[model samples]
Target: MTNSKNTGLVPPSAFALGGDLNVTRIGYGAMRLADGPERPADPAAAAIWRPPADRAAALDVLRAAVEAGVNLIDTADAYALGANEELVAEALHPYAEGVAVATKIGVLRPAPDEWVPLGHPAYLRQQAELALRRLKVDRLDLLYLHRLDPAYPIAEQVGTLRRLQEEGKVRHIGLSEVTVDQVREARETAPIAAVQNLYNLATRGHEAVVDYAAEHGIAFVPFFPIAMGAHAGPDGPVAEVARQIGATPAQTALAWLLRRSDTIVPIPGTSSAAHLKENLAALELALSDEQFAALSALGQDEAADGVAA
Candidate 1:
């Protein structure tokens, strides 16, 4: 791979999260660290199930990402039954200066594929303490409610995090897979530092959430941020644009997200160290106004087709 650093490529930009923590614009997501030796026979049951096939290599990837200037590392308590957090701590505990390891709570994995939202206030508190233990940190840098349990009141769910913050166990609170209305409502209970949602070039379901976060000075962290739809085919708009920019389709998709909003941060996950560097290198990609508009329209088209991913 060509070394973008030696080619005078600019590093990823930085954002001041919650007016205190500063993180690189392009962060690393740790869910993929759960990739392992076992795969369930049922495709629907194939989720982040067991420990990685190579524990040592997973640890290496985490450390290498930090060494490459990634300050924000995203993971969750549900991933591999919270083993993902332990792996992160095993790799980079006593973390480097300014590094923030963000994790999520409120979701439970009954089986390999079943993800149930359990936002009971007591349960949330219990999970936070467990996360603190597994991550080996006195205070979690950033903690997110993985999903809002529909049966519970939004205030109580977010309020639990507020209580944790008051106790100094969590520095910041975030929400995932929420609507714009949910964000406004949650803010009534606590100060939300970030919003993690499923967003990408082909999936524009949360477009309004992106705009709302930008307007409110909240970070919009897009998970599964590298996916592209049918339009990314060889003769499609994505391919045409990738060829023009001399970047891979993934890089082009990331560049579009970076240009989407100032408050936007894309945490694309990868188990491969080489793929990690390639994703980070996307920070150097600069899209022209025309190119940006073209790629931006791709999402609009996908949304029109009722793409739900």
Candidate 2:
């Protein structure tokens, strides 16, 4: 928690995802381990010819994360057309107790760079089955509908996950990239346990969503959670603060998010084991009230000057 390096670190405190799945507040995102684009310009070709990520390396990262006390690992089927999930299985099929693996469905890759929503009850059910097989699990620790299907009713989409929970395929259901209203609506249809959204120091438009998740005891997971813009400048507040505390700007950003709300779980992803350790070490960087407030107020000056936040 200081400028001096500390070895054999203990990870950040744990959070109860869905009020039951105990996981470290600082978790790892599996997307980077996939070694492929989120949406390929040629998904069909990539699927047919794409090579797997370094198997030994990916396994090392997974084992390292677990050893670091990262109990929660986030991923989706759309990532690498299922290779990521398979790799997770290959790396940690006989998952240790207390390790929670979360995955998503409802988005499909149909053509080159094309994403299709398949929220039909049958499609959702089938994907759950397939994901279970890929992750090599009897039941999923957590399942998220990657995104809302514009063509389908939100209730139906959430309701499908409820059915899966009833069938014991998934223990909990969540929504991703949704607004506050959508979270409320989805909750009425089924117990919404978590909300994943794009939130970072550079973007704060989803502030209301974060607040709602906190007030409702729903975990708010921010993907692509990192420092950027003025906050990441070499001479800016973030860098200065990080330097003063002997941490990286990226780690400063993660620490800020940790102080944002107890419900916030920032799953920062990285392909390098070194980077993953660096990101996790941010947990030790506790910010004073002034530091946290400064980060929370980031981009306000730009907005006051008519600059985009």
Candidate 3:
């Protein structure tokens, strides 16, 4: 089986976020903006607690991503406790036209490894103001609730963003790691332009949310969009598909996501410019229905394995 339109390696060049703010389909995730152990023995052991080991190189990566045609840059206040936002501002303070800087609030990082949610209206409002200052922008291009605080009503959290949007502090509101029901609840208080969640070719936990966002015209920004895991090893499913597509396993994963939905704007973060380019190149690798189905089945198998474990 083949898709007549996508059979010839054509990816939608851009997606209109919130009926405006058109950004390239392949965006940059700035989480790796700070210096940290690149590949720790345990992936969870790494942390972004301080400025980049080499601030200049980090800045160069940010600038290079934009220069390479990536328009949406994703960051968070929790990163380096606001230092990451500062880095974004430093690299591109007077943002060029069409460059959208998205920052998330409502998460507290007391310790390097600890992430807690604080959704008090006052705290949320203060963070937004601080983000504007840190990002050196009067109005944030996109502001997301980093995580929902179970202690507070969803309405209260989203309502605060609505108030901020009304005040022109936030041009568009978004949510991270939320359920469809939460999205519905959030819409009652305000419009949600995007939903950022942990989604990829290997992880299907948010499969429903991806569909929901697409049906509602909301952008689904998958954070870890290139995680192919062990299945991407040589002789594994991902590698098999990658060989067939004339690309790397990682590129194959990203291409699968790009072909999965036009509403999806994948933010695959990388500290190296070469790897970033490789990720973006996935846009040109179109998958046929057979290849797409093979990867889809692999994803379901991986997801089921995860659930079993």
Which runs of model 1 end up more than 4 angstroms from their true locations?
Answer: 1-12, 36-41, 304-309
Which regions in candidate 3 have their CA more than 4 angstroms from the true location? 1-9, 36-45, 302-309
Instruction: Write candidate 1's Cα lDDT for 64-172 as tens digits.
Output: 9999989999999999899999999999989999999999999998778688999999999999999999999999999999999998999999999999999999999
- Error of model 2, residue 280, in angstroms: 1.1
Candidate 2 Cα lDDT to native = 0.81
Runs in model 2 deviating more than 4 A are: 3-12, 36-51, 301-309
lDDT of each: 0.89, 0.81, 0.88
Candidates, ranked, lDDT: 1, 3, 2
Question: How much lDDT does candidate 3 score?
Answer: 0.88
> Can you give the lDDT of residue 170 in candidate 2?
90
Higher-TM-score candidate among 1 and 2? 1
Model 3 scores a TM of 0.93
**Against the true structure, whose lDDT is highest?**
1
lDDT of 2 at 115: 65
